[model samples]
Target: MNLFDRLLLFILSVVALVLGVAVVLVGAAVPIGWAQMELTRHPYNIVTMVVGGVTALIAIRFLFFRRRRDPKLDSVMVAGDHGPIRIAYDTIVQLANRRGSQLKGVASFETVVRQGQGGLVLTLHMRVLPDIDVAALAKEAQNAVKSYLEETTHVPVERVLVQVTELGDNNRSMRVWSGTGA
Candidate 1:
């Protein structure tokens, strides 16, 4: 057991001892004296005293006994007794990479996984095609990643942040949708 538990047990034992002595003195000695006063020598003297002492001893013994706390095998223990928190971090990043690359205006997206105070945070540094709505694309990608992560694991996504890393203008020359802007 730990030092705190041991200290608690010691305190309980001392309390029990004090109460036991008080029980013996009050129940056995005083009552025995009263019996001698009522009867000739002692009417119900010895029996009452023995019973009281025995009962007190038994109660004291029960009081000092304690229950053990559940311990862990690992040296690193955090958030005790909540539940299982075995989250595969790599899997969440992979989901982010895939989602970021799928944006219509995205050129390429790179990700950096950071461990924060709360949990793992995925930071996506995305290279987007120029003239595309970068802000909207970043928001969409963040939402997608958040949804996917919450669905996948228990560690929780503290932050799904996107950084615009670079720009590519190749898609502007495709001329496929020119009828609308003309």
Candidate 2:
């Protein structure tokens, strides 16, 4: 929910809490003149019931049907004379993954594309061989993926982030030697 909706809910909750407390105090016969007068009046009771019912409905709406504001790009459009060419976000992700996988040292990788102010931002998380140079590999992957996406799909790539999450055992080796060097 947005800030306004959240603030509204907060205000409603406070008002409901205060009304409930007032009803309890009146029921206990606190002898407050104004409270007793308001509780005894027929119109006041109807107004309170209506306000409470509206507040309940608002709370229910917020709880069940709140809209999310996540950055999910379903498609990208390219301007053209004939018509706009639309490319699916999943297709872009697949292309980026394929380009990144060309790097021999990468064990596994995942690609995520998000819509940004300038254009689209591609993020890559890769598991690579332990012995490989991480800095060089990340840079190469970033450039390659950015170029491929922008060139193929005509989508402006704002940035490409490559995070090396794990180093795999691709370069590891096991050997055993006799104690006496036999």
Candidate 3:
């Protein structure tokens, strides 16, 4: 997917292949050890070594040179030491922001989170482009929020309440964020 993921996969492939070859070699060595034989007697040893080197080289290329990359988000929603849910409120806010930003016509949005007026309610102050489908966007965001938070954090998100805060023209607001730049 992403650069990090591709590299990880490459490293794992190399390791697994090496381990597999090693096992075969060790298995062959046991019988030879009993019979007092040498590696030169086994013609397949050369082929095995060559294949192992080629496999390692290919893995290295995938790990270092491939261009297409995806974002590797390992951590999403882990719970807190002392909270109603293991997941912190900030975590929910982050999921809301990510979901809102992913929507097609969202301009920008700010999160104003508060303790649930009902039960574990999340509210988003989303600014959107004027021409967007408001209802469909809300539905999409809600679904994404629910799916991501549940899978990553292992927490049940009861409600994602969204409010259309404003229609953004996109000049000044785009340059600023609720907090410092990443």
What Cα-based lDDT does every candidate model obtain?
0.65, 0.75, 0.63
**Cα error, candidate 2, residue 117 (Å):** 2.0
Number of the candidate with higher TM-score, 2 or 3 = 2
Question: Which digits, one per residue and each the tens of the lDDT, describe model 3 over residues 128-150?
Answer: 77666788877887777667766
lDDT, model 3 = 0.63
Candidate 3: 10-residue stretch with minimal lDDT: 69-78
lDDT of 1 at 72: 29
Task: Point out the worst 10-residue segment of candidate 1 by lDDT.
Answer: 69-78
Winner on lDDT (1 vs 2): 2
lDDT of 1 by residue, 1-182 (tens): 78797788677667766666676676565554566786576545555556657666765775666665333221112342686444344555676678767666777777777666676678888877766777898898888777776665544568888888787656656522222456
Model 3 misplaced stretches (Cα beyond 4 Å)? 1-86, 113-119, 170-182
**C-alpha-based local distance difference test score of model 1:** 0.65
Name the top TM-score candidate: 2
Against the true structure, candidate 3 reaches a TM-score of: 0.43
Clashing residue pairs in all predictions, respectively, total: 0, 0, 4
TM-score of 2: 0.63
